[model samples]
Target: MPHLTSPAPTTAERIRSACARAGGALLAVEGDDPVAVPVHHLLSDGSFAVAVPLDRVSTASHGMAGSQALLELTDYAPLPVREPVRSLVWVRGVLHSIPPSELTETLDAIATENPNPALLQVETPRSTPTNDDETRYTLLRLDIASVVVTDSTGAEPVPAADLLAARPDPFCDVEATLLWHLTTAHNDIVARLVSRLPASLRRGQVHPLGLDRYGLRFRVEGNDGDHDVRLPFHKPVDDMIALRQAIRVLMGCPFLNGLRARR
Candidate 1:
């Protein structure tokens, strides 16, 4: 029997991508008593930083300034499935609060690399604020010691340097929107794609599961069990134009309905 596999993004790439689109994440601050800190986080290069509002900081402030913590960031399948977690990343590190004096400079550097809406709360108000309480934020950074990523393929360790250097997938930001659009607006095209599966699995309810730079993954809900199928592209695509062409190829015809096959 032959084995099957689909090409996937590297572990570092997956980790970086997950951080970029973090939705449900948990920050566990470890000590004699482990504390779960609510955080709004940002990732710059390899730096994993989070902003904690002072009002809520007291909960985990006992040993939080310099504590061992693990940040778990998970990526779910764009479309809902029995198990929606598509990928998971664990970052183990020591937490360090950014000194007040350097907060402005640090935020500027982070914003340049990756501008996120989460930074709004901690941002220095444009005009001097009357009440300092309104803008009190304790900026914290996780000095990453090690990182591990897990997905359908398996688990793998990522080096700090590799995570820093790795570039996120070009399609990372728009993947969810694209998949949702495909299912809602152009389901006829989705049905066409599902036809590539084996006859046994064709009868199952089809759900758009995952989309990456390399291929598309679909989940088939059936009587016996659920099945996941991958429609691999001949080559990796990094942009929308190439993705459209790749998808067309996967739809079983490289050309349009009216067009004749190339000789």
Candidate 2:
């Protein structure tokens, strides 16, 4: 835990570098069982700093001296051709002693990219809802122990055992995606739409799409519209995979599942 006195000229560059380098780093911290978190944190003072978690953390280590831990970083880029699902890694770097500012900014980026996040408005049987209640902050503080970088083309095995130690606690968006298909078709379409898209045109929450009692709805920012996709002779193929799965279940019970009139 060292802090910088003055701002560094390359501070911004280093912050970006720290984020890029930490993509797959192994975060090691002394805990009851030695917690290992991902290293995709950012550096602010052009170096490493203590990361604050959104959830409850053990403050025992607060006054204790900081220790160093090793990390592994990975960056994936798609191959020139599209036929085979392949990618090329362009840049790779290792970091040490990352700054606190960088870490905070990095967490913000990850939070923004969170997939299927739970809305703050929804209430369930689980707990009481209140305006004061907010999303927990999942933070990753880094003190770069040592780092090694390589391209996907390289065959050598980069030892990142310490990196893979802790299970990545699912972020907000991730939780949403996991619980997405629980009772709605909205998530299915969103995930599929995002997955099938290229990086150039990939938009997450840019366009909010959902399903209602009637059918699906699509809108940008403040403008949205709902339309019945099902039609005679031609049907909306918007979500064929889900449609097919439902069809299979329906076919299993040819009686239309009690819809037929008994003679």
Candidate 3:
């Protein structure tokens, strides 16, 4: 197979993009025994902001502020296949409660970018913790110390500032549906993409793996094992219209050439 230089998203951008797709993570905090709680969250200002159920973790553990905490987010492939896991993001950080003064403002800024319904369920800092608190949750933050993103390529540490600066992939949200439609309704189109691969890789059964602004991915189920490969578009495309044109160009679709002629 030809050794292709991967033109993938920067580690920072990939981390942030994965976080955007993640709905929940395993929140591990220090205790008599390390406590790992499954919780939904919001990422804001370099922290994993979560609504911790009152019944789950003790509120007095606040003394452990700045203590070690771990947050794990898993990214799955857009389409179902033999190996569905796409990437793993592990964040090492310190866990603590968000003070009342900052709760409203922090959520406000987060809402502007991510108006996740989970944020609406969070109680205001002034609200009293009630006996029925099991149904409710408290706001807390995991201040990041270091982050590591592991994917098909390999594992590497991503800087905190770099992750904060990067934006999620423009096509991340629609990628799954796009791949699903192609695989279920247009398998031949996706299979046509495999011809771009080297002769050696074409031996296996080809399946649509993923889609992003940069290009397409194919998972080949070979007799030995599954092989993942990428075929980059002529360039990055940020929207559906541009993406349609890019794919057509990559596949040498004459339809796109007709459109370009008019321009």
TM-score of each: 0.81, 0.26, 0.86
Candidate 3 positional error at 180, Å: 0.8
Candidate 1 structure quality by residue, lDDT tens digits, 147-195: 8988766789999889877877898889899998998999998988877
Pitting candidate 2 against candidate 3, the one with the higher TM-score is 3
Give the range where candidate 1 is weakest over 10 consecutive residues by summed lDDT: 31-40
Give the Cα RMSD of candidate 2: 19.8
Question: How are the candidates ranked when ordered by TM-score, highest leading?
Answer: 3, 1, 2
All models, RMSD in angstroms:
4.0, 19.8, 3.4
> Candidate 3 residues 60-101, lDDT tens each?
454445668788888888877888888999988887878889
| Candidate 1: C-alpha lDDT | 0.73
TM-score of 1: 0.81
lDDT of 2: 0.31
Ten-residue stretch with the least lDDT total in model 3:
32-41
**How high a TM-score does candidate 3 get?**
0.86
Q: Is candidate 2 or candidate 3 better by lDDT?
A: 3
Q: Report lDDT (Cα) of residue 62, candidate 3.
A: 49
Write down the worst ten-residue block by lDDT for model 2: 225-234
Off by over 4 Å in 1: 1-6, 31-45, 59-61, 123-136, 199-203, 222-227, 256-263
